[model samples]
Target: MNDTSRNVSFTDPWIYCLDHGYVTPMICQSTEVLCFLLGTPALVWCLWISLSGSISGGLKPTQIFPMNLCIVELLFCIEGLFQTIYYLFLPNNNMFLQVVYCLFFIAWVCRPLFQTCICVERYMAVVQPVAFIKYRLRRYRMGTSTLIWGLAIIYPCFTVSSLGYLTKTNDVLVSVYCLGGVVISFCCFFILRALKQPGPGEVEGGRGGEKKQRTTDPQKMRAFSIVLTNLVIILVSSILVAVGFFTMPNSGIDFYCNTFLMLLACNMLSVVVSPVLHLHREGRLHCRKGPVTN
Candidate 1:
């Protein structure tokens, strides 16, 4: 048998335990398992909605952006499920395992970048309707989507291979955090700016000689409000993760629990809540009565 003694050490109790043939903590295992279970259902639902052409009103070009976002989230969550299972069941896979874990981390990190793009697209639709419509032509949308994905993947790859670092401490435990806080912060700032912009196609018009002012539609305003709420959730979650890393002492139960749960919550929240909110806003939840028109 492989020598498990080398895995355990005094500094990192968790790794020591794993190395000494003890199971990972019940709470950690349970949380990971639950994340996997929840993520699976959420991913399946997203895929079903994306493919059914019912989620965003028959695959309109505008809807394609969010649908692509859904696909990325689904793929990331599915990869997360596999990583959780592998960690729980096969903890000692060494370098190959580390590479797999890093791949999963890349997916996790790329999610927010894609989300920021989605927010930008929505902002354009509302604040620059003319430009948005022009860009919705097939060639432009396809080319833009391709560019976004390429940049998202390539940037992270460069960071991970360059300045990004992942390592075990003297404590011997492994943590898979990365250093893209600046990117995340920049994304949040832009998304917030987009959210604050006025709705699309506002023009001034008035009775008699006076021009009537163009204004945002109340329904569209409500949709923006929903998007704003989701953005706040994401921003707050990202902030908490950053704070936890910087302020909390390393290798503590509270630290690990908070950081892991925060990230897991952030990912799951976008996957599970976004579609529901969109459905609600579009009145699709009442489809049994009749199909909701967007």
Candidate 2:
């Protein structure tokens, strides 16, 4: 009888509503406002640095890739700023909210896609020098970047357009929740492949008189480090969200808090951490030289 009563309570819509009532609409508004206030200036700074082009020097390809990643981050951050303001100020307008949510999803998902491409570029630079040099021309790089952006946009747009129709069903919601699982698995697979491969300097000894060494290439290590770091962020946040949604019937408090934290962590990855990682890796943080010279 007690177990039956507990199940009944858990399944009741009123009970769910009561449990989550502490997360008022006003609090959501305030949180969005605060996130926007902190994100805008950072976005502008990243853009300014990217446009200055002062960092374009030796290893232009390598330097420009980070700048490209920074540009993507800046764009996403600006989008996030708009999203936060929209959600905070006009929470009840469903049409506008829907548009903002769409934009938010696009920007949110694209950040990692762009970062993945950057990783692949770095891997190519270190692992396939001859091919990398051959394709290092401005036209080729620009074309490649365009292709990546197009694919990223197209993939999600198609999925959203088709799958969104089914979101009204409970089963569809569960399937939609599994989307992050697919992304996480794919990213981890590629990152592991990149890590296992030998880097550029690994095969060749330093010099005739120098000792043969097995040290990891700094660039490759940095590439691996960045990918692994972001992967951990994405994976942990996704898991938290999944657990929250899946276990919501059992514990509404845990579900709400974990979901909120997951959303915030994912937003931080898209808006803050991505650019910071690029800036730090490129040595642009302290240098007044505009951007980091690749």
Candidate 3:
């Protein structure tokens, strides 16, 4: 009877949550395995590609942002992957629980700071080209990056092992809003870059002195595609974070959705390195006329 009761409590939704504060139902175990197994390899490959490019070309302003993102994602993945393992195998020791919270909190908070850095950098480059050039001239890009890193390192200090850090409804609401805002900004920036008018020199007559519509450079198009892809992936993860952070309904669908989101959030930043890998594979950034002009 004791073994049977123990087994029941192990898989039971109500007692299970009470016993293991961060864990979910046994039904969610498969989702955890799937996300960990599939996501980790892709992220590892993504990191390798990003790291290789950084070593070969040195870090450009754009590359710096993504590279930092890649590193943050890797840390998150390592911590998450371990948490899943611990939940399955080890008994919930208080010390281990504190450690898990510490790592997860660090990844949770720092990941966004790096992601915001990427968006702001890309927005400047793709939308406000003139300002981007000025920022580069004044070394503002480096300064901004330095500031971001400092904050990433510091933000986790206050939150390590604190349940309220990520769980507070107010914080979750703010993060969801900020994340959604950045996603929209990135989309707008890409559209503006793609639809930008031709340079003054490129304006030419076709048959009867009409200005011809110019196509965007293939290289630039590819770069834009890659960044957009990254933004979309990260935005999806952010939504997941919001759902998991906030109190949602206890229905079956809601449970599954939040679990899946939690799993995906572990390594979604892998998308950050995909663009860099694609650039390396294509031998240059996809757009023909590069946007990172002086």
lDDT of 3: 0.56
Better of 2 and 3 by lDDT: 3
lDDT-sorted candidate list, best first: 3, 2, 1
Best by TM-score: 3
| Candidate 2, residue 93: lDDT | 64
Q: lDDT by residue for model 1 over 10-125, one digit each (tens)?
A: 12444544444443344445544565566556556655766777645655666566666766766665665665656667666655455554555546555655565566676566
For the record, the alpha-carbon RMSD of candidate 3 to the native fold, in angstroms, is 7.0
Q: For candidate 1, give the lDDT.
A: 0.53
Candidate 1 lDDT at 128 equals 72
Alpha carbon lDDT of each predicted model: 0.53, 0.53, 0.56
Q: Regarding lDDT, does 1 or 3 come out ahead?
A: 3
Instruction: List model 2 lDDT by residue over 1-294, tens digit each.
Output: 332224212113323433556453334344445445655566566656656665463335555555665666555555656655564476466566445545555555455455555555655565566977887777766676677577645654554445432132223323443565565556565766767676666755667845466667666666676667777665564455455445544444443443543455454544555555556666666753333445
Give the poorly placed runs of model 3, Cα more than 4 Å off: 1-44, 53-57, 137-157, 160-166, 169-180, 183-196, 199-203, 212-216, 249-294
lDDT, residue 266, model 1: 55
Candidate 2 positional error at 109, Å: 2.7
